[model samples]
Structure formats: C-alpha cells, structure tokens
Target chain A: MRYLLLVYAAAEEAAALDTRLALELAERGGLLAAHELEPVTTATSVRVRGAATLVADGPFAETCERLGGVYVVDLESLDEAIAVAARLPAARDGVVEIRPVVRREG
Target chain B: MSSVATVFREEFGRSVAVLARTLGDLDLAEDAVQDAFATAVERWPRDGAPANPGAWILATARNRAIDRIRRDRTLAGKRELLARLEREAPPAPADDDALPDERLALVFACCHPALAVDAQVALTLRLLGGLTTEEVARAFLVPEATMAQRLVRAKKKVRAAGIPIRVPPPEALPDRLRAVHATLYLVFNQGYGPPPRDELCDEAIRLTRLLAVLLPDEPETLGLAALTLLHDARRAARLDAHGDLVLLEDQDRSLWDEARIAEGRRLLDRALALCRPGPYQVQAAIASLHSDPEPDRRRIAALYDRLAELAPSPVVELNRAVAVALAEGPSTGLALLDALAEELDGYHLLHAARADLLRRLDRPGEAGEAYRRALALAPSEPERRFLAGRLHELPNGG
Candidate 1:
C-alpha cells in the first residue's frame, strides 16, 4: 500500500528544519518522495465550480498551521504509514494526515 | 445435558476467534459463527447433540464461510486470500488446551487506542461477547442503526490501519494494557450494575483470567482479576429477595462465597508481592478489608489515604470519607463530605453518603434534604428505592 503523508506545521517550525534533517527523516521513513512546499504566502488555491474554475488568493484556508511538506511512501499497512508519519518532525509541532492512495490497478 | 444454548455460550468466542484468524476478517468470522450457531439451534434437538459439538460447529462455520467467500463476486480482489484460507484451514483442535484462544488477540484489537472508548466497548462486547449489534446498541442505549454504523466504521479502521490481531510487544504493553483493562473493567461494571447481566460478568472474568495467564508478570493484570473476583464473591448478598439494593453492613456475610473470597485474597497477595501498588491492587485491598469478619475501619481508612495519593478522584474521596466515618466519627465524615459538595453535587452516591453521615449525627433535617437530592439523581430503581427507604426513616417521615 502507498500513503500520502500531508505534513502541516507552523511557519517558524517549518523554517527551522535544515535540508540534512529532512533528508535523514525521509530516508529513515522509507519515503519514496518528499517535497517541502513553498511558504503559504506563495500558495494559489483553485476550485472547480459547476462550469467555471474559481481561484483564490492565499492557501485553501487560513489556518495557523500550514501545509509545509508532503511525503509519498509505500508501506505494507496503515500502521506502518502512521509510524512513518509520527517520525516526521512537523508532526511534533502540527499534524500529519495519512491517506491511503487509491490503486488504479488491482 | 448438553443443549445448543450451552454449546453456543461456551464455543462462540472460541469459534469466532479461530475463524477470524483463518479468514483474516473479523466481520466475516462473526457472521460465519453466527450462522453456525443458528444452524446448531435448528438441528441439534432433532438430531441429538453432536459427539464433538465445538468441532462440528467450527467445521460447519469454516465450510459456510469459504462458500460465502467463493460466491461473493464483490470479493473478487480477495480471491487469492480466500483460496489460501481454503487450502490451509486446519481442523478444529481436539481439546480445550489446543483451542486457539484468539479471544485475547481479538480483545487487544478491539480495544486499540485508535478507536473511541465507546466504540472500543461496543466492539469488545460484539466481537468477544458474541453479542448482536442490536444487543450492543441496547446495552449502550443507542439506536440499532447507529451502533451498526459505528461497528462498521470501527472495523474498517482496524482493517485499514492494519491493527495487528495479536498482543503488543513488551515495550508498548503498558499503554495498550490500560486500554484493554479499561474495556474489561467497563464490561465487568456493566454486568455488576443494577439489572445485572451475569453472563457479561462471567465473560469479563473469563477474559481477564486469560489476560492474567498471558501477562503473568504484570501485577496490574492480576490485581484486576483479584478485584473482580472479590467483588463478584458478594453477588449473592448485593441485593434483597425483591432485588432492592442492600448496603454492605446490611448484607448477610454468610451469603458471600468463601471460595471466591479466598481465591481473590490469594490473587491480591500475589499482586502485592510484586511490590507494585497500582490502582487495581489498591481497590482489591479495600475490597479485601471489607470482606473481613471484623473489618479494621482504621486500616481501611489508611489504605484509602494511600489510594487517594495513587489515583485521586472525587469518587475515591467520597469512599475515603465513608471509611473515615467508620474509623473516626460521623462529624469528621460530614466535614469531608461537605468539602466535596460542589464537586459531587450531581453524583447520587456522594449525596447518599452525606445523608447517611448526617443522619448518624442526628441531623435529620439536613439528612432528609440530602436524601431527596440523592433520590432525584439516582438512575436505577433499586438505588432510588434504597434512598427512598432511607428518607422514610427520617423523623416526620422525610
């Protein structure tokens, strides 16, 4: 199974993380891919209405904790995904939502 | 005589647990076991009981489950898993000792911390107690549909989250053990409460005993078993012939089970010998004190003092005050009760205890008022009747 770990953290908490630490954590967690998002200030939100595409300024919603990074990892079970999510530094300061990726093929 | 009902009660948990292990699906295992039991109820009387009822049920349940899996087109993706189970399904164990006893694992899984406490209790009863969804819903006073959805969601989480259907490792045992203990305690209390369900109590005790065997070195496990046994020993004296509440002092000590009391005391001794005084051990100790022919009120008071330090709560303080009243005097207990008034205003037992102390001190007026307050808050008929009786005893018939 594959899970998308959406890492959210306070701005300052996300800033404090060095590349070395992030890489180390990703390696330890068996992360297939890890991407640190740009600051929430640079985010552009998009939504699809009945027949029109709506655009918004700032992130999807205003919140103290912002989506700071994401990790895509393959694991045997949701328990393993949770374990990996707990390892993310952002999880200490904010939240890491683990969502199983729907497999298109059986 | 072996009846289908007796066989169902004895074999339900064992069959479900073993089937779950083989099928790797709790819901399917439960369904299969239910079907097997239903079939037994229909066929047993006409055919006479099977030579080996447990094995018969297991084999029938297994065959039924495999057939269901094979026929369900929606489970096409799981064809490989189903095929594996079909090939590897072993015959049921010949003896009780050989039985898989997967209930321990099922309990741990059901009580996993990821699920809400309410959901955990419901799942434990449904899965381990072999209760129907409606029965569980009725127990918790929820609608059948609501409970069905809750169980579905919880089971989905268990499967999706890959909560292992096995005991946790030693390092993680402490935290997981608390959840497991809390569920078992809730089960036992439900059965021990008014309009008691003896079967639930028996199931809880049996499961807790299994837990004790599985965790032999864990003092708290043994403490819990002791606490349950000690309390259950007094079951015969807990209520009157009419099922009204009977206070401890008013209960006939002769009615208490001496064998169970001795067993409880032995377990308590073992738990205490571990030199680890946890909440359950403290509670068992208090029960032990209460069981004595000539109970030492002063010693019980002192133990309550220790317990307050270990796990302080309003309920404990209320109990401690009652012990102090016996050890010291009514006035002293009254003072402690007064301090807890605001904190425990909504609690009927606190009010009842206060009323008792007040009455003992010859303050009939205040005692009457307290009794009224307790009567208003008391939920059960027996408890309300007991309080009303107390009120009627007041001067001028409060």
Candidate 2:
C-alpha cells in the first residue's frame, strides 16, 4: 500500500535550503514518488457550521514551519516506509511525518 | 571441485544473472545456479566436460528446479517463477553472444534504483565485476562490515519490495541511469583521489571498461571513462618523494602519463560533441583542459563556471573560485570566497580556499587562522598535513 511521507522543517532552515538544490531534488524526484510544497505559512484551513462554511486563520498547528512537502510511495512494510522517510533530505533537518492514507468508501 | 567447475564458480555470475532474469526470482535463481555448480563439480571431471558445459548446467538446474517445484507447498508461486525462467534462453556460456547478452541484463539489474546508492555500487562491484566485498569496501574507504551491511540491506529491500528484474521503463530510465552514473563516478573518485595509493585503481578501471562495453553508446559512460583517465594521468605528479602534495602548477608535467591524457582528451571531445552536458562531462572537460601542455586558464575557468551552473553547490563554487583565481586574479577570487565563507564555514575546502587567497594577498595572520580551521575540519591525515604545512609556511610561522 502507498503511504504519504510528509516533511516538516524549521521555518528558517527551510528558507535556507538553496532553491536550486531543492528544486533539483524535486525535479529529479525519487524512487517511490514525491513533491515539494510551498512554505507552510501560506496555508489556509476550513471549518463547517450547520448551514455555513467557516475559514480558519491557518493550518491546524502554529509552528515555525509545517507540512513542507509530501511524498506518496508504494512500499512493502512500515519498516521500509520508515527507511525511505529517513533518507529524505528534509529528514536531516526536520521531521518526516508518515501517515497511512484512508481509502474513500463509496 | 574439478578444475573446470572451479573456474566456472570463480566466474559464473553472469550465468546467475541470466538465470535470475529468466526465472524472475532472484533468490531462487541464485539457489538453482548454485546447485548447478554443485552438480558440475561432481560430474565435470568424470564426464570429461559435456559438449557444452553451460547447456549441461542449465538443463540440470532446470530439471532440478522443476522437481523441487512439483513438491513445493507454494506450488502456484513456484510454477509462476519457473514459467518466467522458461522465457529465457538456456545458458550457453561458450557462446560469446549469449554471455554478453545475459551480462548486459545483469549490469542493468545491478544498477536497479530500488537498491540504495551505496548498494548499487557495492553489488555491481561484487556480482558483475567479480570483486570481493573487502575490495569494494576498501575502494570507498569504508569498513568491510559496513559495506556488507549496505549490500545486504539493499538486496533485502529489493526482495521485500519485489523490485522487478527488468530494466526500468524508458521514462524512468534517465533517473535510474543517473543513479548508476553517480555510483560509478563515486567508485571512480575513491580511486582517482591521491592517497592510500592502493591497487584499487586497476579495479576501478576494469569496472569502467565493463560499464562502457555494457553501455556502448552512452556518452556519459565515455565521459566517466575519460574523467578517470584524465584524473589518473596526473597521479604521479600530485605528490613529491616525501609524499607531500605538489600543487598542480609546481608539479613536473613530464611526470604526467601522455598516452592516458591523449585517450582521455579524445573521449572527452566525443562526449562534448554529443551536446548533452552533464556533471561528469563538465568535470572531464575541466580535467582535459588542465592536461594540456599550456592549460588555458580562461577555458578552465569557463568550464568550472558551467559546472557550477549545472550543479551549484558550495563545493562547486569553491572549485570554480580556484579556477577564477587562476584566470582572473586573487582579488576577484577572494571577494567571491569572502561572500561564500559564512555559508561554507564548516566545509574544509572553504577555509583552505580562504587561506590560499589570504596567503596570496600577504595577509599571513588571517591565512594562518583559516588554515588552522581547515586543519580542524579535514577528514583525512593527508589533508590535515597539507593545511598544517600551509600554516607553517606563514611569515611568522603561526
């Protein structure tokens, strides 16, 4: 099954990574699959009321940087998934958040 | 073991590769090939060798595997694996054509992206190039145990992931090929760099030749070969009788290997003609320019500029800055280093570069400080000595 590998970095550190390198890594891609996201500060959130939709100020948490990017990868085991996660460039500087994606029930 | 069987066991990896791809089960094919060798040891001497030793072995292994599959608990899976094996031509080791074709698959297999970068190099050296793990480890300056672990982990990952044995699809091949190129170049660097001076250079050259043969038309492969030759051509001039480094300009150009330089330059010209610029090609171009009787500083500087543009990093910048120092002047290079020093504080070469520029500018005290910093950050004894020598040469001997 494929799982999402989410990268989170310190805001300052993320800003420090050379754009050329980061973009090259994104373009070169990796074995499973991955993509880099814009910085977390630009994120928006939403909430629901009985008959109205409400927008929040930002992402679920307030931190230096959050959800730097996500990689969806097909792996054989959780150990393998963790291994792949650990190798990500961001993993050297930040936390790599791994979560199983729930399939939609039709 | 019979002499013939011993020879085959010594050099039967290509056989295993063909069997593995044909069988579509790397582990099982490995086992079957081993069993075939065992049978060969028992029969080759008595039978005076079959009309075709490879055919005899293949037929025997195929029959043995079929027999085992008939009794296997996972009959369906075994049957599928066996069917895949049947798709490949039976081993014909005596036939040059069959051996090269099978070995070609093995080369691609060794370069599988599923393998970790380190594993790809280690495994390629082991299986395809017939190198021991110790030899491979020594080439990379890593502990043998660590190299073994890397190889084991990579193969385990491949098996666990069920990585297909076939070459990657066309769309995916470029990245996969890059990984392979990087691995080869890494191994080559371990040989090219002046130090340890072990016989690993021979092994590296052998591996590159194999890669060139397997990837006949790849300009990058040729570029890699050229890079190795050009870099190695200057090996004799890099050190003095006491093993101290002799800076390029001070070294005796007569010590350079002319034949290797000529070959490397020719290959580099062809690679550049292809117009597909890559990191290796750029590096080869730099090496080629340096090999000339009167290396054009402008050409060398321009090549480094392109290299920095292609793969911009503090390391590239530092190298290019050296060329810039040569082509332009110390002041221009010093300005560039001054700007980059903060970002590359922890990097040894940065301090070394700064120290060099400071020395040229007659700022001996600052140069001494930079040299010391570089000595502290250096990973090897030789580099530390080089830095220390620079510091000792300061006017006040700081």
Give per-model TM-scores: 0.87, 0.71
The lDDT leader among the candidates is: 1
List lDDT for all candidates, in order.
Answer: 0.83, 0.71
Model 1 spans > 4 angstroms off: A4-29, A37-54, A57-68, A78-105, B42-51, B76-79, B83-89, B92-96, B396-398
Off by over 4 Å in 2: A1-106, B1-13, B28-76, B91-94, B100-108, B138-146, B197-200
Best by TM-score: 1
Per-residue error (Å), model 2, residue B11: 4.9
User: DockQ (C-alpha) of model 2?
Assistant: 0.05
Q: What lDDT tens digits, residue by residue, belong to model 1 across residues A30-95?
A: 667778788888989899999999998888778878888877777765656766677667778888
Per-residue lDDT of model 2, residues B23-135, tens digit only? 54455555666677788788777877776666666666666666666667754466566666566555565674454346555656667765667778777776656566787
